[model samples]
Target: MWTINDFPAYGSLSGWSTKGYLACPNCNIDASSQSLRSKIGYMGARRYLPENHNWHRSKLFNGEIENRSKPVELSGEQILQQINLGTIDGKNKDTDKARLDLEDMQIRKELHLIRHANGSFQKPPALYTLSPAEQIGFYDFLQSVKYPDGYAANVSNCVTAKGGKLVGLKSHDCHLCSKTLRVTDLEKLQEQIILILCKLEKIFPPAFFDVMVHLAIHLPYEARLGGPVQYRWMYPIERMLSLLKGFVGNKARPEGSIAEAYISKECTSMNQLQNENSPKATDEMWSLANGPNALTNTCLGCICNGVQFHTIDRDNRRKCQNSGLVVKGDHEDQLIKFYGYLCKVWELTYLFGHRVVLFQCEWYNTGSSRTLRVEPHVTTVDIRSRWYKDDSFVFPSQVQHVFNVPDTKLRPNWRVVEKFQHRRIWDVPELDMPEFDEVLQDDENSTIVPTEPIDDVVVLRRDDIVPQIISMEVSQSNKRVQPEGVMDDAFICDDDDELTISGDDEEDEMENDFDTDTDLEF
Candidate 1:
């Protein structure tokens, strides 16, 4: 329902006067009078209309008077393009090139000045000149040139540090350190703006104190909306409109064409929902797992009955037998040894095939003084498990068992063990545990286990529990260690700390061209 009038050009709406002497939006410094002036002179000192009235001028100068005209008005884009690539007036080729070259050099210097003034980083060449929206977004002219206690620099630092982190509330807690820091930073920013305004009145021109500049003071309040500026910007609507423009195939009847295209797309989408043969629904269910344990088509392990197991090769079963593998134990820091082959089980469902693996390992109980030989058992384990030392053993390391090898239903169900390493504790001194205590109520009908007396510590045999350390051979050298107080005499020199200077002969020659003894005075 918006019209051209509702969305007026920002420049026109701001009552921006392209001609005549205009004060800077920030410092109220006349643009034409600035040390580094604009190529297109738009701002400078001038007499008031009443002071230069026709009657006053005629009376003072006897009819002879100075004449003035409105300055040429240029669009923001035109001004920026001239600043970046220099004036592109259609004129003599050689003169234009030389002028452009000089203007380009001056523009580069001006860019550096603006960058330092705003405390922003060096902009890329592509962004040397500001776009219309970018000019409004930056609003650089509204910022104070200086502030008390280097307030401008502090505000820049605070904004740079906290801006990116304030985009979402999902990861932030209201009472946490991050949230508190943002609040304090915002307060400091507001204080700096107020301080700057108080001082700006004394330094800048009257035009600098305009309402447009004052509007900048409320930016912090706007940012407190709990997300980045882009979230509330018009970019999404603009993008959607651009997309709709592409949908217009008929130029004469563009609106009708766009509507038809949009409705047709929606109808097609609705029709696709009822079509079971469509690939979209099936594709949604085939998504792969993410993170360190992401699943792949060539995955070596699978889960069955709430337990994970690894696939093994039947041909290499003999090679994997007695292979030393590190398996997690019941205790937090405990690791156990499991020696055997890994095997898999296949099952046929109504729609898809399923595969699971089993670890056929010999359990070596290390809790006793002697290496107690526990009965061998087959159980489901994580497929990621492998031999820690040598993998070349007698039994098959991995095997793929086919289900239709006649009757997987007749086979015994794989045993699932409890995973002790799943629960992790990450407590530290500064990051203390939560304040609240968890309440655990016992069920009246549930049976409780009886407490048992502690047993004596068992001294394990050296061969049974020897620490596994992989040792590397070291080469012997004749180099001797130096005494603590001794210094290397070879590196000592009289000019060790002195800096060396290199003379530029060309620069000296250029400087000699200018006569320093000249009596010229300003």
Candidate 2:
């Protein structure tokens, strides 16, 4: 029987009371009479004062030593104009206007500003505007302000604890409901509220103790009946109403328009679900150039051109079917050319369809060893091209790291040799190379290892090499594949060979790499 409409609104109790006092709902402080009035007057008066007036000083007029300043009273019309109380003609001086004028005069006298010799009153200053940082600093200062008996800290802690409980509930932590809404916490909250109200009575007005203030005391009971406050809160419902309001194209018949829009949306959604052939409903199939026997379905040997090759296992160890040779003698001569010597090779299928062979090559560097290190860098190459199998000795000039390597080599005429070296030949002792398969598995797991302290070279996977290409694509596609539901026999199976890599340890290794650059050989 109890509906939300039955309860008083949050701000219904706010505004100036019949006694001519303005109070805050949360602090229950009278803005017109007490410390709040002084603070407001002080801040407001500072805007109109000249820069040399020493605004930071506690008392501008040295009130303790000097005689008490005479209070300057203004007329009803002046008071109304000063407070923006609307235009009231001189002919109508009603009892209400007189009462308001008297109240305004009393507030002005309490503020205590100096009256000029000419008898003209100092105008109330504009509101103080603060930047984001200054606003935060001001809020912190207000929160830190102590109550008479040092109850401010206790009140602040209680409010903060209550807020944390509300946040937990909003995040769907239902288990915390019992602990947060315990009878002890509720009693403590009530006591704190009472103490705060008492302390603030001298400063705040009756309007400050609004319905919300009383609601805090009954929160525990409300939680008992409704569960979490978030579930019962109007914010989510209000947000949904705002969204529904956007669908109202016909203002004359808003309800009808909203209903029709809702129905159309539902119908469209239902059609999308039922229609499997719809482009939006289905995922794009991978477009392969070389039929089903593409590199994605088969091994790297399919495009090897009769050249023997090996696969890099999960542990990064080379598993050789024959001799672990990537290319034979003549075939190696055809693939290797002016770009560099192919030091290491890897076959990878990126995303859905992208399949290519990544060649790690060491380019000929003419510069002094100190100027630059001719490190083996990885780059993608199209397997379908005839240049990959032909004996033309024409290299793909679009190399990844060749442009980065300085061409300070003193001897340019030195012939670049072509040879079939094992994968270990390209492995640097100091560099802990990132696994390609693992990097693709989870982007968050990937760590950037700086090659050296001085050099800004970050050694990541080949897929993570090119900043323009890989950075966006890899991050968007890389998702951790959760294992499917375990079968009855899965529990009995052993996973001893599975490499358990921690993200923290990987980051630590990368950080350590930066410090141990001295041991690294060029």
Q: How do the predictions measure up, each by TM-score?
A: 0.22, 0.23
lDDT over C-alpha atoms for residue 72 of model 1: 38
Q: Which ten residues in a row have the lowest lDDT in candidate 1?
A: 171-180
User: In angstroms, how far off is 216's CA in candidate 2?
Assistant: 4.1
Model 2 residue 352 distance off true place after TM-score fit, in angstroms: 12
| Runs of candidate 1 exceeding 4 Å displacement | 1-8, 14-185, 188-218, 221-228, 268-522
Best by TM-score: 2
- Candidate lDDT values, in order: 0.29, 0.29
Model 2, stretches more than 4 Å misplaced? 1-187, 202-226, 233-237, 250-256, 268-522
Error of 2 at 303 (Å): 43
Give a tens-digit lDDT track for model 1, residues 322-430: 1223343443366554433333322212121222223444333344423222333323333223333332322222322211011122222221221121101111113
